[model samples]
Target chain A: IIGMMAMTLSSVAADHLPSWNEGATKRAIIEFVENVTEEGSPGFVPPSERIAVFDNDGTLWSEAPLPFQAAFAFDEVKRRVPTEPALAADPMVKAMLDGDIGKLLEGKHHDGLMRILALTHAGMTTDEFDRRVNQWAESASHPRFKRPYLELTYQPMQELLDYLRSHQFECFIVSGGGADFMRVWSERVYEIPPQNVVGSTAQVRYEMRDGKPVLIKTLDQLFVDDKEGKPVGIHQFIGRRPIACFGNSDGDQAMLEYTTIGNPHPSFGLIVHHTDAEREYAYDEKPPASGKLTTALEAAAARGWTVVDMKRDWNQIWSNPDAASN
Target chain B: IIGMMAMTLSSVAADHLPSWNEGATKRAIIEFVENVTEEGSPGFVPPSERIAVFDNDGTLWSEAPLPFQAAFAFDEVKRRVPTEPALAADPMVKAMLDGDIGKLLEGKHHDGLMRILALTHAGMTTDEFDRRVNQWAESASHPRFKRPYLELTYQPMQELLDYLRSHQFECFIVSGGGADFMRVWSERVYEIPPQNVVGSTAQVRYEMRDGKPVLIKTLDQLFVDDKEGKPVGIHQFIGRRPIACFGNSDGDQAMLEYTTIGNPHPSFGLIVHHTDAEREYAYDEKPPASGKLTTALEAAAARGWTVVDMKRDWNQIWSNPDAASN
Candidate 1:
C-alpha cells in the first residue's frame, strides 16, 4: 500500500502543472505538447513552427470588476484630474472615477471613452508611456484579490507557458488590451517578452522634439486585437499561424477557429471555462463583461476543442498551491 | 618563406566576410557583433536583444530602373487589361503600361495610384494575396539584371544576415514595400521569416464568406512604412528597439535614428552608399528614386554611423564568389 502511494505521489510530483488537476483537460495539453515535440512522431512540429498564442485578460488572470487596462486608465484619469480641474469636471472623468460602467456604456460613451483614452494613453512619448506602465504595474493592486495585479495571473497557465517554452515552443500573448501596457510588465509577470505581445495599438507618430526624434502616441486607434481581429493580429505580427491557442471568451472564438480549423498540421485549441466562483469569477453562458462565451461554448463541442472547467480542472488558480486545500 | 606564405593564406581564409574588403566598415561590424555577443563583456547583449533591422529596397537588393513592386503592379495591369476593357481605358492604367512615370507623378497621380493599388493589391483575401505574391515572386524578373528579382539581392548583405544570425542575432527586414509581398519569399530569399518582416500594410477586414472566415485586403492605405513611419512600423511589429540598423537611404534615416540614437545599449548603425555604377547603380548624392540620401549622408559621419561605400568596400556584389574575377 505504501509503495502504491509513493508511486502515485511520484507521478503527481512529475506533473509539470502542479496547479492543474489530473484529468482529460490536463492530459490533452500534455499529450499535444508531447506529440508535437517527439522527434519521430507524425505530428512532430519543428521548433520554428512551434508557436503558441494565449489571450490575456480573463484567460491569464482575473478580469473581474473590470479589465485591468480599464482600471489603469481610470487611475490615470484620477491622478491627472487633480492638476487639471477641467478634466475632473468632465462627466466621463467623473463616471470613470466612480467606477460607473453604466454611464460609460451609454451611446455617448464612445466619445467619452475616446476622451479618456486620449487623455490617459496619448500625448506622451513611447518611452514615457512604457515607464508609466511599469510604474503602474509595480504599485497597482487588484481590488477584490487585494494583491498586486501582476500576481493575479493563473498559476496553471504560467506553468503551461514554461512547459511549452521548455519544449522549444515560442509563446506569444495575443490580447485585446493595450499592447504597450502589457509589454511593459509581460516579461516580468509572464516570461513572455515585449516582442511577443500583440494587442490593440494607438497611432504613434515619429517627430523631432527638441532636435531629437521621439515617437508620440496619438489619440487615433490603429488596430484592435479582438474577435476576428485576433487571427489577423496573429498573422500581422507573427506572420505564422499558431498551432496551439488558449483563450477564454467569445472574443477568442474566431482565433480558435482559425487555429484548429483548416490547418494542415495538427493543432490544439483550449478554452478556460471560468466555473470556479470561489477561486475565480464564473461567467460562461452569460457574462457581464465583454468576454462573452455563448457562441464559442456552443461550438467548442462540435470543433473538438477542450473546454477546461476551471472548478474541476484547476486544483489551484493563483500562484498559491495550497489555495484549494485552504 | 613557405611557412609565412601558408600563415598568410590561412589568415585570409579566416575572414568571415570574403565579399567585404579590408576596411573600417567590415571591422566595425565584426567588432560590434563580437563585443555584444562576448560573455561577461560590458557591451554584451543577450541573444533576445540582439535584433538587427535592415531596409529592403536598395540595401538588400537593386531598386534601380524603378522599384520591383512598381514593375509587378505594371505587369498586373497589363495582364488584367484584357479581361476588363474599362480598366484598360483608365488613364492610370494607360500611364502605367506606357511607362510614362511623369504623368503618374503629377498631382492627380494620387487617385490613379490608389486605383492601381486597389486593382492590383486589394479585393482579395489575405491567403489569396499571399498566393498571388508567391506566384509573382516565382515569375518576376528584373528588367536591368535580366534575372529573377530575388537574385538581384546584394551578396554582401546576404553574408551580413548570415553572420548576424550565426552570432545569435535576430534579423528583421523593415521595408517600405508591402509586408505580404515580401513575406511570400523572404524566408527562401533572405532566410528572414515572415514574422521578422515589417513593412507597409494594407487595411485587412475580417469577414465570413460562405461559412469561411477570411481576412480581405481593402483599398485603403493603412500605413506607409517609410521615413517617419519606419520607426512606428518597427515598434508596432517588433515591439523592441533593435541593436543594429542598416539602410541605404533617407527613407530609413528615422529607423536608424530610432535604433541607435537614444538606445541605452551599445548599438551600431550602417548606411550602404551605392557608389558602383558599373556593378550596381550609384545614386547616393543625387539619385532618381525616392531613397535619396542627402541629409542622412551628411548626418551619418556626425552620428558615428559607418557609411559603406559599395564600390570600394565590397569585393563582390553578386552571389557568385568569382563575379569580381569575371
Candidate 2:
C-alpha cells in the first residue's frame, strides 16, 4: 500500500509542479537541482552536501493580516488575561488587545513582542507547549483566507520542497518564527520534519517535575533567527553552508548573502516578491512598516538571484486555485 | 572504484570490531544494533529515525593531559601574545601561562575557560576560525601519548560509528567541546559531518568584511553543552529523540536519562568507564573534579545502561594495538 502511494506521489512530482508556471523561476530552480545532483557534472554536490534552506513567513505562507505567530500571541493574551489579572494590566498586553502594532513598534518592536511572547509562550513544559501549539494550529484560521493558517502555505514552494527532497537534498526551514511553534506543524504542513526546522528560540531550562525531566520555556530570548542573526543561526544549527536559500523580505537578505556570496560551489538564491495583490497581500515594495523589500528586490538582479514574481511565476498560489476572497 | 572501496570497507566490518575484545560489551552492542535494525521486529526503528549521539571528549577520543581544545587555547595565547600584548597581560592568560589550573578552577572554572577561549577562539571570521582549528589539530600532539591528538581516537568507537552508519544510522557528536573546533576535523576523523555535530558554542555575529560576508565569533557564551545542558543541546540541535546515546562522564547522565528514561521505543545507553590506566588515563571514578562518574556509575546498572570497563572490554584501544611507551 505504501509503495503504491509512493509511486503515485513520485509520478505527480516528475513533471507537474502544478502550482508553478513554466517560467524563468521554475526553470532556474530545476536547472540548479539537476546540476548539483548529476553525478558526472562539475557542479555535482554529493547528497551529504545537498542542504537547502527556506524562510517560513511570506516565502512559505501568508504573513499578512499579521504573522500567524503574532496572531497566536494576541489570542493567548486574551485567553490567559481572565485568570492573570496582572497580565491584563501589563502595557504590552494592553497594546496587543488594542490591536496597536504602531504603539508596539514605538520602542523596539522585538522588545514589545518578547514581552507578550514571554507571558503567552513561557513557563509551560515543552511537551505541554507543543500540545497547545498543535491544537491552536489545527483550529486557527487566517482572517483573510478563512482557512486554517497551515493551509495558507504556498503550493509552489511546497512543490519545490518536495522536488528538492526527492533529489536527495535535505530541506530545512530557517525561519525567524518560534522554533517550537514551527516544529508543531512543519512536518504535516510542509513535509519538512522537525529536525530540519530551525528558527528563533526562547531560553529553556531543564528541570525535574514530579520526578520527570521537563524543559520549561523561559522569558529570555535565546537567539533571534532574523536579519544578521539568520546567517549566525544557520551556522549555529545547520553547521554546513547551504547551497540554496529561499526567502522574502529585507530580513532574509543577510541569509541570502551568506549562502551565495563567495561560496565556491554552484549556489542559488531566490527572492519571493509579493507582486500579486489580487491573489495575496502585496506590501513588500510599498509597506507601511514591515518587510520593506525595496533594497533586496533591486539587489537581487545584480546578485544573480532569481526574483520570483508571484503574479507571473506561479500558476496558482494555493492548493485550491480559486480566487482568494479578501 | 567507489563501489569497490565501499565493498572492501564493508568486508572488514563484517566480523569483530578489531579493537574490541570478544565479551559482553561487544556482544551487547552488536545485539542492540541488530535488534533495533531487524525488519518486522518490535524493536525496529526506521532508517530516518535511527539517530545515535556520541559524546566527543573521552568517549570518541582521549581528553587526558587536558582536552585538546584547552591545550589549543594555551598554545593560541602564547602564539597571539606577540602580536597583541594586551592579551599577554590578561589574568586568564597569565594564569594559563603559569599552568595554574588551581587559579582557573577557583570561583568559576567555566568563566575562566571562556575568557581564554574568547581571546583565542573569537573575533575571527568563522571560515578563518575553522582554518586555524584545522591547522592546530594537525600539528598538536598529546603530551604523554606523543602523537597527534586526533590519532588518540579509540579504534573500537570508530568501528562502532562505522557499524552504526552501515546499519543506516545517522551518527551525531553531541559534545561539550566548541562546535567550531569540532567542525574543523570531525568529518575527516570521525565521519561525522559539521551538521551532525552539536556542541557548546560562543555567540557569533554576521558582518561584511571587505565586501565579503563573514560570521564573526563573539566573546559571549551561547551555550554550554554539558551536564543538564547536554539534553537541552540535543533537543535544540537534533530535534529527534535519539534511540542510543554514548558517553563516558557524569556530564552525559542527563542526556542518557532524557534519551532512554521516558522513551517508549527500545533504547540503549553505553558508558565507557576508563579503567585501563596503561592504555589511557583513568580519572572518572576518582577525578580532580572534571567528569566525576560516581553518580552515573551507580545509576548505570539500575538503568540497564551498559558500562564498558576499558581494561576488560577491549583487547586493544588504539588502532595500532601496540603498547605505547612514554
Candidate 3:
C-alpha cells in the first residue's frame, strides 16, 4: 500500500507538471526529484539540504525586447535626462534614451549600462528606490506581450518552483538583476520571499536622518551577480551549495557547474533553451537581447544536464498568456 | 476560555523561561512575545515578518577572552608562522600571537584585527576554511572557562531563542563575527541555520580548478558587520527590517535602533548586560573585552528597550556550565 502511494505520488502526469509536456525533459526533472525526495532512497536528501536555484530573466520570465530591469534603468535614464541635462553628456544616456541595447552592452563590464543604472538606481534612500520600483511595476508593461513584466513569468518554471517547494526544496532566485529591483515584487509574483533573493547589490550605507534610520544606496562598489559571481553570491548569501540549478544563459554557467559538478548529494541541472518563436520570442542562432546561450548550451550535453527546448517541452508559455486580465 | 489558555501559555513563571527569575525583565520579554504571537491582537505580527535577530558573541555565548573568530584567526596565524616564518614580519601577526587585545583593537576599523583575520581567513578555498573551522572547534576550549567554546552558550539566552522560535519567530544571528565561523556550528549550538546568519563577509571569487568549481576566499571586499555596519549587513543579507533585536554592546546600537524606531510593527529590543562577576565575567566601569555596552546602555531607557541585569535576572548561566560532560 505504501509502495502504491509512493508510485502514485511520483507519476509525471499526476497533474504536477501540467505546463510541462510528456517529454524526456519533464521525465528527467521528475526522476531527479523522486530520487532525491523519496524516503530511504540512496539519493535521498533531507529537506534542509535540498536547495534549488533559478536565474530570473531568461529562465523564470521573458527577457526579450529587453530584460525588465534593463528596461527600467533605460526608462529611468530617459526620464532623468530632461531634468538633469548634465546626464545627457554621457553617450550611455543617449544610447539608453534611444533603446540601443547593443551600445549599452558593448563594454566588458557593460560600463555604459552600469553608468545609466547608477544614475537611476543609486544615490537615493532604499525606501525611495523601493517606492519607485513599486510604482513603476504597476505601470510598466512588456513591449511585445503588452502585460506587466511580473505577469510574463514562465508558467512551467513557476510550476517547477511549486513542485520543488512541495518536496521542501528551498528555492532561491540567483539573478544578475539588482537585489532591490527584484525584491519589490518577488514575493507577490514568484512566492519567493525577499530574504531568499541573491542578486546584484550596491554599496548601501546606514544613516540616522531626522530620528529615522535609512539605508542610502550609493553609486560605488556594485557587486554584479553575473557569470562567475553567481556561485560567489550563492556562497555569500545562501551559505550552502544548491543541489538543483536552473538557468538559461552563459551568465548562469558557473552557478550550474557549482550546483551539480562533484556535489556529494545527488544534484540536478536544467537549461531553458529558447526554441519557441511563435508563443514567445526566440532566436535562430543566438539570443539577441540578454541570454546569449553559447558555451553553456554546448557544455550541457556532456554534463548530463537536462536542456528544455521551450517549444518542445513546454505546453504553455506565460502563466497569464492573455495579457489583458493579468 | 481562549483568554484563559492564552494567559496560561504566556505566564513568565511557566516552563518556557525557567532560567529567568520572576522579575520585570522576564515579564517584559514574555509580554512582548504574547503581544506579537497572539492572533487578533493589535500588536499581532504575521509569522513571515516575525524576524528576531540576535548578536552571536556576547549575546549568545561568552566573548571575554576574545571573540571565537579572533581566537581562530590567532591560532591559525600561530600555526602558519611555524611554516611561513615571514608571517611574523607583520606587527598585527605579532600582536595576535601575544593576544594583546588593546593593540589589536586600537584602530578605527580595528586594522590590526582585520589584518590578522585576512592572514588566516583568506587566500584559501572556502571548503578548506570550513574544514579548518570544524577541526579547530573540536579541540579549541576557552582559556578561563576551560570548556569547548560551543558549550559556553548562555542557558537563559538559549531558552529565549527556543521560546521565540516556538512562537513562530524566525531567529537570525546578526553578529560582529565572521559569517563562515558562525555558520559552521550555529545550527548545532543556537539552532540558527547558516542561511539565517548575517555577519562580516570577505570577498570570495568563483573559479574552476581542475574540472571543479571552487570559491576562492579573497581578502579584498571585507564587510565588517560592526557598529553601523550591522544594519547595513542586515539590509544586504536579510533584505527586510527586523521587528525584534537582541544584542549587547555599542556594536549593536544601530541594529537596535533600526529594528525598533520608525518600525510600523510593535518592536522589541533587548540588551544583555553582563552584570555578574562570579557566575559570568563582568566589568564595573568599562567592559574589559569585546562587548562594551556604553552608548546603547545609556540610550536604552529612552528607547524602551529591556536591559537584562545578568546577576539579578538570571538564576543560571551556561547551559552546560560543567565542562567535563559537554
Candidate 4:
C-alpha cells in the first residue's frame, strides 16, 4: 500500500517536477517515505503531522552568486531604464542593468541588498509584475550555464517534492525572496502553486478601481522572509508548525529551528550545502552577495539537521539538463 | 492497512478535537475517509491531491451576532476607555464600549465593520495583541449559551479537520475575521496552530526597538478574507487549491467554487446550513448578523457542493453540553 501510494504521488509529481534524477536523493526520499507510511513503523507519521517546508532559491533549485529571482529583477530594471535616467545613474541599479554581477555584489550587507530589492520590485500591480517575470524567464539566460535561468533548477529536489507529496506531506516554498515573485513561476517549475509559496512581500492595498475591487501594491515595506522572518512567516501564514524543512542558507535557520521544535513525532530538517562546483557553483557560510548561511551551520549541527553535500549526495543536478543545454 | 491508517489518523484527530460526538457526523467522516484512501475507488485520492479548506466561524465554532474576536475587541476597548473620554463620546467607540451589539451592526457593511475593527484592534505590538486575545478567550462567555464562547465549537467539524488530516488532507481555516485574532485562539480551540489560519489582516511593520526586531500593527487595511477574497486568500496563503471545502454562508461560496474546480477526483464540498434554532440558532439567507447562505445554496446545487443541514446532519452540537449544564 505504501509503495502504491508512493508510485501514485511520484507519477503526479512528475507531471510538474520532471527534474529529479533517480538515485540517492530519490532512494533516501522513498525510504523515509515508506517508513512514515508503512503501518506500525516507529517513523509512522499521521497525515496531519505530515507538514513539509522547503526553501525556494537553493534547496529546490540553484542560487549561486545571487538568487535567480534577484537576477531577474536586475535584468528587468536594466530593460525598463530607457525612460528612467535616475535609476540608470544609480550605482546598484546600473550594475544590475549592465549584468555587472561583480559590482552588484560590492560592499552590500543583507539589509542593504533587501532595501535595493524593495525599491526595485515594490509598487507594481501583481499582474504587471507576473507578466514581467514570465517574459524575463522566457528570455533571460544564466551567465555560467548559458541557459534560461528557469532551467537551472535541481532535478533531485523536484523528485523529492513529488516523493514526499505521495506520502501525505504538505510542501511549501519558504524563502527570503518576494512571495509574489516566486509564486508567479513556482507552479511551472516546482508544481507548488501560488498559494503554497511563502516569502517576502511588499504592502498591497485593496481598492475599487472603476467599480472593480483590485489589490494594488504600495510603496511600503512588509516583512522580508529570511533568517528570523522565516519562522515568523511560517507561524503567521501557515498557522500550523511544519514537520519537515529544507533550506540552504542562514536565512533559513529560523525555519529549521521552528520545524525541529515540533513535538510527538520527530521532525526532519535538511540543508543543501553547495559543494558541487562543477555542476553548480559551490560556496558556504558566505556567498558574494548575501552572507545568510554562515551563522546557521553550528545551529544546524546542534539541531541535527541533515546537511546534503551537493557534489556527493546528488548524482544529477537538475531534471532537464538536455533541454537546458540546448 | 487502510483501516489502521484511518484509525491512527482518527486517534490523533480525537486528541485535538475531543468535542466530536460519535455518530453520523463521525460515520460520514469515516465514509469520506475510506473512499479517499481505499485503493482503486473512484473517490480514492492521493495525499498530494488531498487539500482541505475549512471555514473558521460558525462552521468551526460559533460566531453569531458578532464574531468572538469582535467581542474581545469590544471588551478590550471598554476596559481601556475609563481614562479616555474621547472614545466615550465617539458613537462607534461608545457603542462598542456600552456593549451595544446592535449599534455595532447598524448601517455597517463588511468593509465598514472591518475599518472599525482596524481602529479598535491596531496600534499594539504583536505580543500585546496576542495577550489580549488570550485573556479575552479565557473569560468571555456567549450571551445565549452562557458558556465561555471558546467552548461553543461545532464538535463534528473539529472531527472533520482531524479526519481529513488523517487521510492526508491539508486543512486550513479561511475566514473573513482578522487573521492574527483567530490565530491566537485557533490552536487552543481547534488544535490548528496559527500558520493554517488565513483571514483579514491590518498592515504590520517590522521595526527594531532596543536592539530587538518586532512586528507592530498599523491601521492600514491589508487583505480581507471573505466572499471573493476567500479564494484569493487561499491562493495567496495555501498556494495549493483545496480538494475539499467546508463553509456556511455566501462568504464561503468562492472557496467552495475554488475547491470544486480542482482536477476531477472524488472531491467533496460541504455547506453547513444552520437549521437547529433550539440547539444552535437556525437562519439562512436572511439573518442580520450571520445570515447570507442564499447564493451558496444555489451555487452548491449547481456546483454539486453538499449542503449539510446542521439540524439533520449533526447528532449533537457542542462537545460537552451535558458538562455545561452542570
Return the top candidate by lDDT: 3
Alpha-carbon runs more than 4 Å astray in model 3: A11-13, A78-91, A100-109, A320-326, B11-13, B88-92, B98-111, B320-326
Write the residue-wise lDDT of candidate 2 on A1-326 in tens digits: 65575456445554757778877787788778767876666798998788899998889988886888888888777877999999989997898888877666676556777788888688888888888887777677878789987788888887888788888889999998888888877777876777788898756788777766778888564788899888988988888899999999888999899888998888999999888889997778765335668788888988899999899999788854332221
Backbone clashes under 3 angstroms, per model:
0, 0, 0, 18
Q: Where does model 1 sit among the CAPRI classes?
A: acceptable
lDDT of 1 by residue, B170-226 (tens): 999999998878887788788787888998886677776776667787855478889
- Fnat scores for every prediction: 0.52, 0.58, 0.73, 0.28
lDDT of 3 by residue, A67-121 (tens): 8997787767766678787888888888777767678779798887777888888
List all candidate RMSDs to the true structure: 5.4, 6.0, 2.7, 9.4
On DockQ, the candidate that comes out on top is 3
Model 3, range B82-149, lDDT digits (tens) per residue?
78978988888887678687798897988887788778788899999999998888888888888888
Q: DockQ of every model listed?
A: 0.47, 0.50, 0.77, 0.18
Worst 10 residues of 4 chain A by lDDT: A13-22
Per-residue lDDT for A35-83 in model 4, tens only?
A: 6666676788887668899987877777767678778866777686888
State the displacement of the C-alpha of residue B292, model 2, in Å, after optimal TM-score superposition: 2.4
- TM-score of candidate 3 against the unseen true structure: 0.94
Looking at chain B only, the TM-scores across the models are: 0.91, 0.91, 0.93, 0.85
Model 3 DockQ (Cα-based): 0.77
Model 1 residue A131 CA deviation (Å) reads 1.7
